[model samples]
Each structure stands twice: as structure tokens, then as C-alpha cells.
Target: MMVSRRETLRLAALGTAAILASHPVAASAASKVRIGVLRFGTVSWELDTLKEHKFDATNGIDLEVVYFAGEDATNVAILAGAIDMIVTDWLWVSRQRSDGGDLTLAPYSTAVGAIMVKEASLIRTIADLKGKKIGVAGGALDKSWLLIQALARRDHGLDLPATSDVVFAAPPLISEKAIQGELDAVLNFWHFCARLEANGFRRLIGAEDAEKALGASGPVSALGYVFHDKWANENPDAVRGFLKASAQAKDLLARSDEEWLRLAPIVRAEGKELAKLRDRYREGIPRRPVAEEAADAGRLYRVLAVIGGEKLVGSTPEMAPGTFWQEPPK
Candidate 1:
């Protein structure tokens, strides 16, 4: 269930107050980092692993997790100086920097959405989508939808939004409509797409494939850990430790089936659904060098700017410099 915007703000305020009260020395403590996370986000899996194995302590930092009801709430928390970091996309970080904010991104996940249809559906190609009733999860400017549009235009010269009837709604609503047969297809978030796959849906095209078709060198992380530049500079060791701990957690989850089994209750999956979720999560772990990832992101950003226009990329003709954070030399 989703909370109202006002309620979410209230929760963020309370969460922030509690964090400050509990950590009176937070400002001076070089070994502490507070991260604002969505209550049900996949990030919890990594954080859970980090805590379960005491990875934070091993890396010499005190990790704090504050829950937010909505993405906007997390943004609000970070902007108001209530938290040190949050998970978000590079585009948003770029927009902030363009507007003179100092936010930067560290790669989090490369998993992207897919266009899904019922297993028996006849929509086997982009051309087949013409005249179909399509459900889009994140509205017109969604990165996945924009990428699909770019793919359609580049490969088949089809204008997806103009050719198909599109219904824009929340991810959950889009999933429900797709399951009910009201939509011929859906472009939804990765996790929802995974669930649909477990229940018999087929992927017609994945966003990562679309990216490759359009010009990305490889899979690019669409989301990442975002933090202020000044804060990171002030606590370099803490930031590096947190990132190290995050990588360790991902390595553990990638190699250990036993860990996933223990996380089953938290992920709320079983059998095929559990397997699908695990595999998808592992596929998203970032492995490319930071420079390579940044270059790919810059190319994709230009494509998005061209296709999505001012609405998606704002007034920035290119991604802002330092949008992807690079660790200082050891």
C-alpha cells in the first residue's frame, strides 16, 4: 500500500528526528553514514546482507538505514540534510547538478525493465505493437519507455507513442491491468517484470537490449547511490567503507544460495518467483570500471536528451560532469 505525500513527509521528518537523537555525534563521527532508503526497495537486500555478516564493522563504519515511504520522501530527506545518501538515478543527479546542486552518483544496479506480454500473445516484434493497447508504468518520460521509443525509431522507424494507445499509471496498477488482460503489453519496472515472468508473461524486449541496439557499449546501471559531494569529501573513508561494504554484500549475494534462502521471507518470494528475483538481482550488480560506466552513461544520456527532450533531461544538452562518482586513488 502507498502512503499519501503528506504522510510520507511526516514519516521522513520523524525518521530524521529519531536518527539525529540516536546519533548525537553523527556530524563529527567519521565512521558513520546515514542512508535513506525506500521501505520495500531491493537495496534492503544488500543492506540486510551487510548487517547480517557485520560487513559495516569490518569496513570500519557505522551504517544507518532510514526508511522512507516514497522516493520523493527520500529526496526531501536528503535535500533537507536529514540523511547523507539515497538511492536514485543519475539523470536526477545530473539535473540537480545542472541546477547547481552538488549531488553525485555511484553505480547501484544495471537491471532495467522489459516490455512484457502474455505467453500466448502474438506481439513478437516492435511492429506488432502498432495499434495495441500498451500500459506504461512511469509515464511518458520514464527511462525505459524513452529507451523503447528510441529503439523502435532506430530499428523500425516506428513512433511507438503515436502508433500505440498508451495508458500511463503507477507500476503496480500497470502490472494489475496487464495481468487482467486489459493491456496488450506493459513496460514496467524490473522487479514487477520479474514477478510477471514468474507468472507466465514473456519478455518481448528488454530495456538493456534496447540500449545496446541504440548504442550503449554494454549494460548500464540506471540507478545508483546518490550523495552530496561535500559530504563525501569530508568523510572519504566513511564513503569508501560504505561502498566497499556494499560491494562485499553484493559478492556474497551473488555467490551464496544459502543467503538467498535466508532472505526469502524478506523478499517475499518462493519457488520460481524466488529464483527469478535472485537471478535478476545478480544480473544488476555493477562490474564495469567506473570510467567505462560513465562513458556509456554519457552516450545514453545524449540519446535520452534527443528523444525525451527537455521534459526528461531538463535543459542540459549533456550529462553534467562528475555525475558518476569516481573513487580517489588509494
Candidate 2:
């Protein structure tokens, strides 16, 4: 039981080295999957995030996350190698695909995007959208498909009218713009959308309409896991794992508001009203996956071709196969 001083020093150094090795910050080298996700809420979700970093705690993803403010910025970050994958709206993915960007929908996420109109407005139906300016939080094509889908359901000729116009605005402000009478309608995801309803706006269209209207013959854009094809092909396992975990996270997020509430501080630290937003994204909205709707993916894409307004990624024709990542295992 007599340890020499030199031996103790040697053991001490080894212990220090071991401690350094286990440090989470250093252990998570940035070289891991740098998923560039959108920080949709004002609060930042991931900050130079690492894999398996417990957002849901259970079934967490093992990757790094770089939060981007919007789709355009997120795509730019992807090109710049700031991160590897993106989980954003499918419409953004469609725009990226049409623009010839190297991104693909390797997995399914959600399909809850919709269009809203003021209940009191004369634009009582999809056909009424003509000649009116619509504000879309995502973009024009999003509104076009929304109107197209809505029209297809109510009347066959009810596709996007050329006479209509679209204005780009933040998702949080879509309803506000409509209430102010500045926008005839709004197309957006659900977080603030429920608020619109509470404030008197009604749902003009939903994703189900996209499928019914297009009759499965066209491409429709919505939401999914968008990542660079080059990276996806090279790292299929990670892609699958990420998707699997995301799917699990989707379930977890649906079952409880605990995770969003726990992560609220990460958002509130930014001085943004994140708790309310978290409640908005969690309690007030629906969370579900769209893996079964591969057919709709193409339909959403075709709808984008009609808008032709945002060439975020590349030309329409270039938005072909080989760009879409294989559907993540269910």
C-alpha cells in the first residue's frame, strides 16, 4: 500500500488525460454530423449542436446542429458546409430541388402546413383568391399549391389563378398582416396559425387538399428532411439514424410538451418571447410525420414548377430523381 510519488504523478496525468477525453464539448468534435436546422422560434435550439444531444432526452439524435434563421439562410449554410442536413418545410425542399440544389428529402417530418383567410373577407373560397395579394410566410409557391389544392377539392378548375399576387412575410406575422387588411390571405405552418383562428381567421386549405386536388399526378411541396445528396449518399447510415431518431422525436414531441418547455430557456435566453412560442409550437399545434405520402412529394414539386417565382435551388427540370434521398426507414 505504499505508492511511489512518481507513480502517483503518472496516475494523476493519466486521470487528467482521461478526464479530458470524456469532456462532452471536446468529445463532440465539430466534424460529427453538422445538421443545419432552422431555429424557427426566436430562441436558438441548437448552438453548434452535437449529435445525440438530448433535445427530447429519449431517442435523441447523435449529431451536431447549426441553427439557421430561415430556409434561404439554412440552404446557404448547407452549401457553405456550416452543417450537413436540414429539417424544414417540404415546400422549401421543393424550391431547393427545382433550383438544382444538392439537397434531398431523405426522411419524413410533418405535413401540417396550411393556408388561412380572414373569415369576414369576400375571399370566401379558393377561387376568390384571384386578383388578391396573399401573404405567405414560406413563399409564393406555397400559397399557389395551397390554393390549387383547395380549388381541386371544391372545384376542378380551382387551381392557382394567374391574376393573384403573393407577398413574403414572417410566419408569426401572417395573421397580423391579414387582420390589418393588408393581406387577403396567409399560407403558413401551424404554430401561429392556431392564433389566427383564435383571432377569427379560418382554414382555407390543408395538405389533404393537395393530394385530392392534384389527383396524385403532380408534385406537391410540404416538409421533410432536406440534406445534401452528396452527404446523404456517403452517409446513409447516419441519414437513416437521424431520420429514425427524428421520427421518434416526433412521437415524443407529440405526446408531451415537456421537451419544448425544458428547452424554452435556450430560446428565452435570446430575449425573445420563447415560452409563448414554445406553447404555440407544442400545445396549440399538431405534430405528425409524412413518410407514407411519397406520392405527394412529387405532387408538391410539380406545384412548385407552376409558381416559378422562387428559383431557390435550380431550374425546374433539373429537380429530378437522384436528388431525393431514400425514404428513411419507418
Note the Cα lDDT for every prediction shown. 0.88, 0.53
| Model 2 per-residue lDDT tens digits across residues 1-330 | 112223434554544343234423332232246565566542133221212245323333356555555555555454444466665555455554544556667543233556788787777767777778877775544544444544553574644445668677767687678788888877776556655666677778765565556564333334455777777666666666565555555555555555556665554422234443444444422232333355555554555455443343334533355444555455
Which lDDT tens digits does candidate 1 get at residues 49-162?
Answer: 999999999999999888878887787677657789999888888887887778899999999999999999999998899999999987788888998999888888899989
Going through the candidates in order, what is the number of backbone clashes in each?
A: 0, 24
Error of 1 at 17 (Å): 8.0
- Residue ranges of candidate 1 with Cα displaced over 4 Å: 1-25
Which structure among the candidates has the greatest lDDT?
Answer: 1
**TM-scores of all candidate predictions against the true structure:** 0.93, 0.64
Worst 10 residues of 2 by lDDT: 42-51
Error of 1 at 9 (Å): 13
Candidate 1 contains a number of clashing pairs equal to: 0
TM-score winner among the candidates?
1
